[model samples]
Target: MSPDVTAFGPDFPFGYDKWLGHPAGLGTIPAEKHGAKVAVIGAGMAGIVAGYELMRMGLHPVFYEPGRIGGRLRSEPFTGQTDIVAELGGMRFPTSSRAFYHYVKKLGLETRPFPNPLTEAAGSTVIEIEGQKHYAERLEDLPPLYREVAEAYDAALEEGARFSDLKAAIAARDVARIKEIWDPLVDAWDERTFYDFVVSSEAFRKLSFHHREVFGQVGFGTGGWDSDFPNSMLEILRVNLTELDDNQRFIVGGADQVPKGLWAHAPAGPMHWSPGTSLKTLNAGAPRPGAARLFREGERIGVTDVWGHTELYDAAVVTCQSWLLTTAIDTEEALFSPKLWMALDRTRYMQSSKTFVMTDRAFWRNRDAEGREVMSMTLTDRLTRGTYLLDQGEGRPGVMCLTYSWMTDALKMLPLPVEKRVALALSALEKIYPDVDIRSHIIGDPITVSWEADPNFLGAFKGALPGHYRYNHRMYRHFMQGEMPRHERGVFLAGDDVSWTPGWVEGAVSTALNAVWGVMRHLGGRTERVNPGPGDMWDELGPVRLGE
Candidate 1:
């Protein structure tokens, strides 16, 4: 467990944390470019991060958000209860997300270990699969079959991907070694699915079919990943290699506070803005209406809000889900190359739904007659693929995410009302905890989210499919606009979708930094010689290009 193993890329291994912490600051814009208005579409993590950096660099970032400012980092509070919240979006944050935690530390927000399965924070875990239920305090306490499944997956990673060596390389930040092992993996696994990798592995070949099934249901980190079986093996490898799933934590107040904090936080000494100037004040306390249309306005980029208010910006960073450009916003075709447009359109997003309920207390902590806790953090093959119990501490109300499912499982509840969804989840939990009366402990209206149903976000986050590496490479490298035609250079993309690892806040934060670099360079600004940005290291450390 080397401290340096933080999401220092398997693709494009640029140290974003170091870049952000550099005393020289991000970069300097020319006096003429000072106060230049840049339209940041969608005030999500990426948008806020990019806007915050741009503002620090003497640029004025005018945010256009259709919905709330926090985007997918949504934290919905229970009715009449401000402190308690349902983390409808990114609830878990891994310590490896050095760049994301940079802001978290800056805001002085408190965090505690996420109660992932088999961890001390979870206290206990219950695994239910194929109608069989098992309770355990840790992996060792589970049945032998469970241990065999876990070992087979670990052996499979080592057999196929050389897991140990590669993880060590990442931990050491050995740039050449990382690319040496990872570049070939991209070529080998990009065209294959995760299920393909698991089934084809020599290690799994030695195990029973039941073992593989268990591996999918009770994954190594977090919970089930069967929903992601059809995704590119390269995608899964990136998550494993970077340790994105392990050592997870959750924000104390809420995940949304990070973005909201940045929105109101003014840099100690911004280049052009006054000392008290902040993004909140820059936009006069609220963001402009959601961007309805994006088009080129001669040399500048023009953004039309939902209210028909059009404004031109020196540069624009589109931080919303890439699909929104096609489904929600009317983006001009000329702004992106045909190949780039294809990538943006082809970039697949995963569907996700979460049903949460506020509870009377941390009642799950009570032990039953058998001495086992009344309820535990749950993973199952039932309707509730994963159930998390969030303890707000003794004497305080707790929150329970009754169900967190993805893809097929998530879509099953897409059309159902919140009440019906809750009922369905409770029914599923009842089967697992036969003696537990979950509904009796309920305290408030349940909260549910079907990300795909929202027009602003066509899906939760990007989940690359087999043979989609070219698309991902195209989107990820778009920030290096030095080679691009002038018309397409000013408008940039930033979000988890445009990053190597989607569905992680680190991706959003890292790509946002890329956009900040792109915008700075687009505006005739340059990073200090002492601190080169992502764009500055593009040629040597950019993602590998695969043949057609």
Candidate 2:
């Protein structure tokens, strides 16, 4: 008899690492296939994690990175500073990213609470809108209208989707309850934008657009969720239902450490590698040249790098943004079916921009004449949509993320140089705290990133638009190509874009593990007698296929 998923109760299959160790975890490859090589393109979180784990299982996983190892998780230190650094991508992470955190904890990295607005770490927040400022130590201190918006959001969630019950079902791994709640939601909300959900809800409809505007400007959890308003409502619901935006924390030194650490970490008692082998030591301190072309060669796959050096591998995992397949590389016509190619071509990426400067110290923490700090975690309607302050230590130097923006807000700053971006942000902040001298405290040159402007990455991350659920479902389920023809079995897609929650690292890790399972199966692996892979239980717990 199949194991009863309901018996697991509250112990869901979401734990990627746990799933690996579970009786029903990934299947194992036979010893004869253990030493076969695997090619992993892109050195991002998904690539690093998947490669490391595969290496532990006795597979020789070679990586191809056009640039640095930490793809989008870039943390740049000041030129002359000892430890002060600016986060150019993925600054904060929520605790719910358990799969990603598994490696973080294993590597023994320290993390501190991120100062999201209304959180205690924030100390205070200034919400600026409509040329007015309101300072609050907590959410309750905000205007009654703001509170009403917050309450209305909760009521809408409860009324429209049985939020509490769905959450309970998810927590319990109650697959039946989950499908009953989620399948219907996917069918109803797949064609609806987040803006539509917010405006059409009975609770939000009762209030004027002013309340909606306030909610847009100063959203709960993370500030200014308006950038996501135009995307699918299912996207928003997935984020909230999974709590991807809550309980966030910053890696103490840098978020890039997650990927960097994985590259050098030696898992305890790894199979074929020596006791101290790492991805770095395994590759002789360098990655294979960047993959420039990919195609099928008989039963195996071939990848040719920029230098025209070609190598054949038993299986390949593509972890970069999917568009690069067509734009940056020479891909064969038959490698991916037309439908899959369409999904890759149609992937919509959201734009993002961030400007940062190293400060002499956490000077913003200094008390003013009125016995209040000069500034706090700030959210505003101005060009600098969100500002975050990072405290390095009590008296040591620190970093300030002057402006982190998305969507149209991100597009507006795309053309500006770093110095001008910093200047523009300072000008906006000056209006909120006319008393604070933001320019005088800067100790180093400013740093900035417009992800959309980066060549290797065309955009920050994927944001599913309304009617894009089918595309996402198709991309995410591509890892299950073992059931496809032999030619398609050797190539796997793994990345945040190929995940349900496109922007969250958890999704990246989850999808990468799925690809690992797919690779194992393709290479003639089998689960232990008692253990079964996710594919073994697809009907009970697989993602709902709407309109199928």
Candidate 3:
């Protein structure tokens, strides 16, 4: 960030500022008349872990990222010519995550460890069904009505890996039993997207009963999507005994050094990072009683911006990608309620893409033999999107890899035309390596984030279907709605859509440690309610049916 952020003007980095740091159970708010004036909105990683717990309570928080800050879990700046870190975007971090390994041991950082970056499955992953292919290698290789629908897709991923003791046995006002059963069993097993779960699964099987891209050749790790499974079998059972590939590490240099270390202890002139400035509207009920202003992208919220510049802070925590709250901004009808803006206008998102290559593990030890895919493979090709293993340690032979593109909503929107995005990355690399020969290492061309072509992160992570946490837990519970009791004091709401497990990064660091224990119970701090974790992690794909 050395001075040249697009010749300045929302380009940031001339001492690139962004303020609002301090979290780890918050501590800072102590300067004025109810001085805890936060504003946080998408600097990613759930607005950098709820702007580091609202600038450690001495509250003055002010982040607002329109772009760049580890949202797609980025990592570029082409480090020292390749020991390989060019992780152009998020992948591998689910090492069982005990509170994301205590936020990487409270930011000392370094989670490098891997006994098996998943190199096992070798053959038989063939499935087509009606059109006919089916091969079978395990779940009785289907055909008993697809092995009773592959035992109900491994009992919907073992009831989406046992819901933290049914969300610590509900009763947070019965979180409506996560809309009558953990949001449709986590969108019918891992956040919906197939013509939106057409009752009793018409098809899309394969959870290690082979074929249907052999769980994308045993690699494309993440979970749910017909049944893709193998984001390293939940990273070999979340890496370290309940999640640990050394805390799925990242951020020694980038992952935007976690909101540049929460904008280096933020708290100055309420944060703002304009960037190609955009947002345009969101007014919501006159100028008083529960406020909400915004404006910027094409102006006019407070007549082209200014309720004192989009109302600084009496209340406004946005933190983007709530389906960009229905395209960038604008919802009126009192900013919320009409059943919360028709549940944030039918909120839906799940389409992803990530490509970064520097290659030279001798191009995966000469692809086959020699190292026969030294582990981590998955590439059954729906335009080949999950190819893993991005090296970090050992005599390092310059190898960094990541090409995720899982269902990238037909090429993520916005002004395209670099030769039609290099012919859609040469037709998604001829549907994944068809006789190789992609005119020499391709380099730059595969950047199609398509979370519905951004109206602001309109869903990629944080999906949740079915009853989706009982009707989108009030759009990720942005520290619950107001009625003024000092507008719900110490306000909080981390993301990955407030959890009972929302789209991962361990439910955005377990909803930023449940908003640093709700701003330490609004600075009178005290929490004793964890009851969520492995707890019989999922008694192997069996009981717990409640179908109604």
Full-model lDDT for every candidate: 0.92, 0.83, 0.40
TM-scores of the candidates in the order shown: 0.99, 0.96, 0.30
* Candidate 1 per-residue lDDT over residues 1-548, each given as its tens digit: 45668899899999999999999998999999999999999899999999999999999999999899899999999987887999989999999999999999999999999999999999999999989888999899998998888888888889889999999999998999999998999999999999999999988899888888888888867998799899999999988888888999999989999999999998899999989999999999999999999999789999999999898999999999988898889999999999999999998889999999999999999998889899999999998999999999989998999999999999999999999999999999998888888889999889999999988887899999999999999999888898888888799999999999999999999999999999998888999999999988888898888997
Measured by TM-score, how close is model 2 to the native structure? Answer: 0.96
Choose the strongest candidate by TM-score.
1
Model 3: per-residue Cα lDDT at residue 12: 7
lDDT of 1 at 528: 95
Clashing pairs in 1: none
Candidate 1 minimal-lDDT segment of 10 residues:
1-10
Error of 2 at 360 (Å): 1.0
Q: Model 1: how far is 111 from its true place, Å?
A: 0.3
lDDT of 2 at 370: 75
lDDT of 1 at 457: 89
TM-score of 1: 0.99
What is the per-residue lDDT of model 2 for residues 336-440, given as tens digits with 9 covering 90 to 100?
888789899999999999999888888888888877778998999999999998889887887889999998999999998888898899999999999898888
Clashing pairs in 2: 10-172, 23-531, 24-532
Please tell me which model should have the higher TM-score, number 1 or number 3: 1
Instruction: State model 2's lDDT.
Output: 0.83
Angstrom error of the Cα, residue 487, model 1: value is 1.5
